[model samples]
Target: MKPDKSRSGCPDPSTNALQWGIKVKSSNFLVIESDASRAQAIVSALSFLGYRPVLADRVDADETGEQWRGAFVGTVEDEAQLEQFLASLGRNARNLPMLVAADSPVATSLIADDARSQLIELIDLPLRYERLAEAMRSLQTRVEPIAASRRFVGQSGPMQRVNALIRQVAPFDSSVLVLGESGSGKELVARTIHDCSPRRDKPFVAINCGAIPAELLESELFGHEKGAFTGAISTRKGRFEMAEGGTLFLDEIGDMSLPMQVKLLRVLQERVFERVGGNRAQRCDVRIIAATHRNLEEFIERGSFREDLFYRLSVFPLEMPSLRQRLEDLPALIGEFNQRLVQRGLSRVRFAPSAMNALRQHGWPGNVRELSNLVERMAILMPHGEVRGMDLPEKYRGALPIEEVTGAALIAMMEEQPMIADSFAYGEGDPSVLPLEGLDLKDHLAGIEIGLIRQALNSANGVVAHAAKLLRVQRTTLVEKLRKYGLSETVQAG
Candidate 1:
C-alpha cells in the first residue's frame, strides 16, 4: 500500500487520534521514515527548528553518507529489518545518540532488545520533538572536547601539564604571565590560551616590548592622535585598541622600561587609557598575556622593574619547559618537522638510533628553535637520507681530548737536556745557540697561554667552571679568554 503523503500529526498508539506537536530546526539529523506522512511532518518540524534533516525511505537506504551528530529513525517494521539497519550503521549506530519513533509497542520492545539500543531514545507512536531536541543538545556538548584535543601535538608529561593549565585558565579573563627560556615556545602557549578562551572570535594582537624603542613604546601601546609627535601625521590605533575584546600578548615584557611599566600599571588598574595627545580616555576590554625569558624577580630586586605591575601581570603564571627537559618528545618533534619539510617540497630525512642518542645528549641552550634549525639544516644537507651519529656536527657528536705541555713534563724534558754550562765552558762559547730567525717573545708567550687554556678546558671535559677551577681563575675570566681566542666553539664541541 502507498503511504500517505500529506503531513499529519503523529497518531497516538492508544487513542488513534492526532496530537499536538512541537517543531525543531537545523540540528543536522539523519532521519529514516517508513511512513510518508510521518516523514513529511518530521522534516517540516525539524526545518522550522533550524535543523537540516535528511529523509530516508529505510534506515539502510540513507544516501547522505555524511556523519550526523544526531539521528531520528521512525516506524521500524519488524525486528529483522531493525537489526539489518543497525548492522548497516555499524559502529556509528552504537556510539551516536539516536531518537527512534516506533509505530507499535512490539516494535519498540524489539528495538530495545538490541545491544546498540543503549544510546537510543525510544518514543512510541506519537513523536516527542521536545525530547529529541534535548538529546541533541546534550550530544553536542560531549563532542566538543574531542575536537579541542586535536590542536596540540605532544604527549610528554610537561606538555600534558601545559595542556591541563591551558584548559583550566582559558575560561577566565585574568592576566597571564608566561615564563620560559628563549625559543622555548612561550608564544605558542599564549596563542593556545587565546584560541580556547571566550574571546576566541575576536582578534589577537602581539607586540614585542623589547623590539620597540623605549621612546615610542607608549604611543604603540596607547595609540597616538593626529599631530601627537613628529611622525604622528594621522590618528593610529595601538595594540590595545586593535585587540579590544580579544587578547594582547606582550612578548618580552621584562624589557619594558620603568616608565612604560607605570603607564601599563595604570591601564591595568583602571581598565582605561588615553591617546598620546588626546584627553579622552578610551576603555579597554583586552585580556593581557605577557611572556618573557628574563628573570623579572631579579629585575625588581635591581629596581629596574615594578613589583606591583609584576603582581598584576602574573595573576596566573605559566612556565614553558625547555626542550631539554622534554627530551622524550624528541622523536615526535622530529617527525613533525620532517612532515613540514615534506609539505614544503623537500625530501624527508630520518635519524638513526645513534644520531637520536647524540642529539639527546647535547645541551640545547636555544631549545626548540635550535632543534628546528638543525633539522632544517640536516634536511638540506642530506635529503631523504638516514642521519647517523657521525653526520651530526662535531659539537653534537662528542667531546675531544685537550692536549697540553704541563710544567712537570717541561721540567723533565729540561733535565734530560745536557748541562748547558758544560757545553758552554763559562763565557768562552755562546751561552745558548740563537736561532737564525728572530722570534717574537710576546707571540711565544701568548701561544703558550692559549695552549695551556685549551688543555685546561679539555682536561675539565669542556666545562667552563671546572676549567676555571683547574686554572685558578674565575669562570668569567676564562670565558672572556675563550672568546678572545675564538675557542668557544671548541668548548661547545666537547
Candidate 2:
C-alpha cells in the first residue's frame, strides 16, 4: 500500500503504522488503546493484514460519509478512561461490536448495566493473530443487532408481538404498563422502551415498590426534606426527580398500598408532586413505566388498587409471555445468557441434546429469570464444558430415563410399569392377535406408547401436567417417555 498523503500531498509517516485523522471505512477498525506498545502491535497486525488502522480522534464517520465496521478498545487504565473512550465514539457508534484487549475485570466494568446488548469480545494479554482474526470475523458477521433484538432476545410469536408493541409505544410519551409473572422480564421490556425512545440519553431509574417498606415507599418516590423523618438526615431527590427528562420505572406497582396508590395517582393526574414535609409542589417531567406481576384489575375489585391509577399506568398494557408460553425460545434465551456469562469472565457451556430436551419438559414457573439462573449455575458447575442430561439439577432431570439417571436421581424418579395398562392394537377375538409370524412384543408396545403420548400431549395444549392427567400417569413418567420417543415441545406445539 502507498503512503497516505496529507491534504498538502506530503507523505505522512505518522499514518504508516497507526492511522490518525483519516476517515474510517467499513474495512477499518477504530483503535482506542491506552497502552502504546500494545496499540502499535495491534495496529501493525491490522495494517499487515490489509486493514486500515483508524484512530479514535478522527472526525465522526458520519461527517466524512464513512461507515464503521467495529472498534478495538485497548487495556483500560481505569473505569474513567473506559467511560471516556466509549463516550468519545459518539452515539452513532453504539452498535459497533468492540474487541477489547483487556482482562476480564475490565470487560465486566465496561458491560455493567448496559441495556442495549452491545456485542463485545475479550482478548487476553500477549494477543495472538488467530484470536484477533476470530474476533474480527465475528464482528464482521454481526455488524447489525442479533436476530432482530438489541435488548430482548427471542423469535417466537409472543416475543415478536412484544417487540412490536415496544416499538409502537416507544416513540410516544404514553405510560406503559408491563404485566407478567415475576421474573418474566418485565423490567427488560420497560428498559427497552426507554432505550428506544427520545429520552434514551437521559436517566432510567427503577425501584421495586414491593421490596421497599410501605412507610418508606412514599419517601422513596418523592424526595423528603432534611427533617422529614427520623432517618431523613438530609434532603434527597426521589426517583421521579432523578428521572427527570427521562423514564422512571416503577416495578411491582400493584404491590403499592392503597394510600401510596392514592398519592401516586394524584401525581399521575396532576403531573406534579412535592417532597415529603415540603409545602412547595414540584413539576414532574419524567415519563412513567410501571410493571407488576399481580393483576391490578383484581386488586382494584378488592379495593387494594385504585381504578384511576390503573388507567393512568395501563395506557399501553404489554403482557410479557412466560417462558412456558414460548418454550420454543429456550435455545435463543440460553444463547443470550451464555453471551452475558462470557462477558462476566465465565466460560461458556452448551447443553447436550438430551439435556436441552429435559429443559423443555420443565414447567418454568419462574420464567426467564429462572432460566438465566440455571444457565449461570450450569456454567459455573461445568465451566467450558457441555452439560449432559445427568448434569442438570434433580428437578430438571427428574424425568430422565433410568438409563440416563444416576443412583441418586432414582430418589426423584419412580419406575413402575403397572401405573398404566399397555394395551395393544390387536382385537381380542382376531386370529391376527396370535400371529403365526409373531411380531416383536417390545416394538409393538412402544408404538402404542408413542401414539398414546402424542394424543395426550395434543389434548393438553403441550402442558405436561395436563397431559399426565389425561394419560393417568405420573408427570415424570410422561416426560421420560417424551424423551424416549423424541416428542419435544415442537411436536407437542404442533
Candidate 3:
C-alpha cells in the first residue's frame, strides 16, 4: 500500500545530512522537546531536509490548523519527571506516534518496553539526525489522515440508526447529549458528529467530569488566570478556550457536583464564562456534546443534576446501545479490533469458533469498550496462536456459544450480571434455587472479586503477569486465585 501523507508536507528523506536546521512554515512538523537546544537542532535538520518544523513545549495539534507529521517527546532522566512526561504523552500522543529521546539508556529502555507499543517510539540520546528523520517518516505513515472517519465499524441495526442520527444532526450547532453505559464508545459517537459537522476543522476536546476533582474542575473547564489559586503559577487556558471553535465533550457529566452543574448550566445558557479569578466574561463559540452513563432524569428528580442544564445539553440526545443490544456487530467489531492490533505490530490472531461462541454468550456490561478491551486482551495475552474456547475466561466457558448472545436479551443479560460470578449467582445453584441477594457481604465481595479477576484476566487475555497489573494486585495473588477458582487449566504459561 502507498504510504499515507500527513497534512504536514512530507520530509524529503534523500536530503544531505550536513544541512541540519529547523523550518516551521505554515504548520508542518511539530517539535515537542524539553531541551531547547536539541529541539532547535532537530528543527534545523528538518528544515534542511525540506520539511517545516514548529517548536513548542507542547502541541495541542487538535487545536491548531496543522496536522502533525511527527513529534519529539523528551523523557527526562529523573524518575519523578519520567512518569509525568510519560503520563502527559499518554494522554496527548494518541493521534501522532512519538519518538521519545531520553538522556539515559535505562530510562529509554523502560519507556521502550512499556509505552512503545501504545504510542511512543523510543530512541536513545546522542541523537542522530538521520535516525530521527526515518522515525518521523515511519510515524507519518501510521497516522491515518485526520479526516472524517469514514471508518464506522459496526453494521448492526442499532448502529445503522446511530449513523442515521449522526447524519441528521451533523449540520447543526445544537447541544448533544450522548447517553450510554460505560465503555459503550460514546466518545466515538461524539467524534462522528464533530467530524460530520461544520466544525470538522476545529478542535474536539473531551473531558471526563468525574476524573477531575471538584476543586480544580472549574479551572479545567473555564480556565484560570495565573496565580488564581495555590498551584496556579502561570495562567493556563481552560478546555473551553482551547476548544474555542469545535466540540467540547463532557463525559460522565452526571458525576459533576451540584455547584459545578450550576456553573456548567450557566455556560450552556449564556455561551460565556469568566476565567477563574478573572472579572471579564469570555465568549466561547464551542459546541457542547455531553455524555453520561447515569440516568440524568433520575438525577434531576433527586436534585443532583440541574433540569435546565440537562435540557440544554440534551437538545439532540443520542442513546448508544450496549454491546448485547447489537450482538450482530460483534463479528465486525472483532474483525476491526483484530485488524487494528495487527496494524500496531501484534502477531495476527483469531478467535476459535468455540471461543467466539463463548464471547457471544457473556453479558458485556462494559459494553463495546469492555468487549474491545476483551478482544485486545485476547489478542496480546493469547499464546501467540489461535484463541480457542478453552482460551476464554471461566465466565464465558460454556453457557452458550458466543453466537447466541445478541440484541435486547443480551442487553438484559449484561445489565443484570456484569461478570461471571454475577452470572452464576443470578443464573442457578445446587438442588434448589438460591437467593444471592440475601448472601452475606463476604460472599458478595468474593463473587465480585472473582468477577473482577476474571475480567482482568480477559483484559490481559489470560496472561497472568499482565492480568495482575490490570487488577492492581500482585502476580502471586492473581495466580493463587486462578488456582483457587480451578482456572489453572486455562492459564497458559507466559
Candidate 4:
C-alpha cells in the first residue's frame, strides 16, 4: 500500500480551477497518465471537481500498513505493476473513490480491466467543465445520509418530493393507492405509510391478490365458518380480521374478480362482512393500502375496473418514479446498495466509475428491484475483488454507456468463452417463448395483457376482481380481456 501525498490540498474550483467557477468538493483523486499533458488534464479536471489531486510515482505506506484514502498512480505501463498497485489499496479500494487518467485509447481499457479503481467520474482530455460538474454533484449525493427511513433512496428532486409526500400523508389513515411499474418498490411505500401511521404497533398484514386463488380468496379475506364448503372443515379468520387495527396491504388489488369486487365493495361500504358460510356480519377495523404496477384507467375503459372502487381506494395516490427519470439518484442508490450488500455478507463487489456511468445510462425497465438483484448477482460472480466494466454481465456489457470496441479482439474473446453462449441458451426449449413480431402492435400488446391476466387469475384462483386488481388493471378490463382471450372458460368464479 502506498501512502497518499497530496500535491495540492483539496482545490476549490471557485478559487483555483477555471470555467463556471462552480464550487465543488471531492475527497481525493488519482491521476494515472504516462503523458505529462494528460496528467495535467487529469489534475485540472479533479481540481475543477473540487478534489485534492495527487500525482505520485507510486503509492507507499504511512506507518502500520495503512494507505491514504487518496492516491494517484502516474505513468503506468505494465499490467503487473497496476495490479500490484490496486492490490495494495485493499478493501479501502472499494470505498475510496478514484479517477483514472490515460490516453483516449487506453482510458477505455483502463475502465474495463481495473475493477478495484472506484472512479466516480471520468475525464476525457480537452475536458468539458459542465460535464465534470455534473459528475461531481452525482458523487456528493451518493455519500450523504438520507433524511428519512423510507425505502426510496434518492437525492433527486422527484424523490425529495416523494419523501415530503410520505411525511405529509403518513400520519393519516386515508386509503392510499401506490402507482408504479413493476419492481418500483410500491409495496415499500405502503410499508412506509404503515410504519408512519397511528396503527404502527398493530400487525401489518400483506396479501398479494394476484398470488391467491379466486376459489379460496373469499375464505382468505372473509373468515369461513367450519364446513363452509368442501375444504372448510375448520373455521379460520380472514386477513381483514387478522389485520384488525393495523394496515391490510392488498398488493395487486387490480386482480380481484367481479363477484369478489362486489363483496369487497360491500365490506368497504359498511365496514362489516359475514363469514363465507355464517350469516354473522363482523365489524371491521383495518386501514387499506393498495399497490399495483398496472394502469387502472386503461382497465376501467375496458370495463374490467369499477370507477367507484378506484375513487374509494385512492384517497391519496403515491406515484413512484422510474430509475431512468431519477438518474441523479443513481450514485446514492449505488452507494446505499453497496453498503447493504456488505451487511448481507457480500462485500467483494465494488462499482468502478465506468460501471456506475453505465448503470446511469442504461434504461432500467425493471427499475430498482432489477438494479438490486443485478448488484447481488455481480457481488456473487465478479472476480474476487471489484466489479469493473468487463466484470458486468454480457447483456449489460453491450449496452454499456461507452462506444464498444468491436471486431477481432472482442469476437475472439467471445469465441474463447463459448460457455457464455451456452449459458444463455440453457432454457431455449421452454414452451413459454412466444413470437409477436408479425402481429399487430395493439393485438400483440393484447396477448401480453391476456397472458398476464390469465397468469394472475390462475394464481388468484378464479377471482376475477382480485386478479384484475393484481394485474393493476380495472375489473371491467380484466373481464373484457377474459372474454376476448376466451379466458372466461377457465375463469370459473367470474
The C-alpha stretches of model 3 lying farther than 4 A from their native spots are 1-28, 32-37, 44-68, 72-150, 400-494
lDDT of 1 by residue, 1-494 (tens): 74443344433223321112223222246666667677667665555455556553333333324455666677655433443444444334334556666554234543433222444566654546786566556555444432332255568999899999999999999999999999888877887898799887566667889988999999878888889999776676677886777789999999999999999999999999999999999999999999999999999999999999999999999999998899998988888767666655677778877788789999999988788789889999999678877677777865311112233333343346334322322233443355367443433444455656867877888988889889999888888777655567777532
The RMSD of every model to the true structure, in order and in angstroms, is 22.0, 13.2, 15.1, 27.8
Q: Which residue window of length 10 is worst by lDDT in model 2?
A: 411-420
Q: Give lDDT tens digits, candidate 2, residues 94-128.
A: 45677876563356644542432356777777768
Which candidate number would show the highest TM-score if scored against the true structure?
Answer: 3
**Could you estimate the TM-score for every candidate?**
0.52, 0.57, 0.64, 0.52
Candidate 4 is scored at a TM of: 0.52
Candidate 4 positional error at 323, Å: 1.3
* Cand. 1 Cα-lDDT: 0.69
Q: lDDT, candidate 2, residue 129? A: 78
Cα error, residue 12 of model 2, in Å, equals: 29
lDDT of 3 by residue, 1-494 (tens): 75533434544434422223323235455555556566656666666566666655343334255545555555343433433332333223334566666554234433432213344566766667778667666665456422212357788899999999999998999999999999887888888898788887666767888977998889888888878899776566677886767788898999999999889888888899999989999999999999999999999899888888888898999999999899889888877776666655665567877777787888888887777677778777873888777667667666543233322333354456555345543433431334665544444444555556767777778888998888788888778777655566666666
Report every candidate's CA lDDT.
Answer: 0.69, 0.73, 0.68, 0.64
Question: Model 4 over residues 404-494: C-alpha lDDT tens digits?
Answer: 3222333344357454323222322322444444323343343345446656877889899888878898888777666544457677665
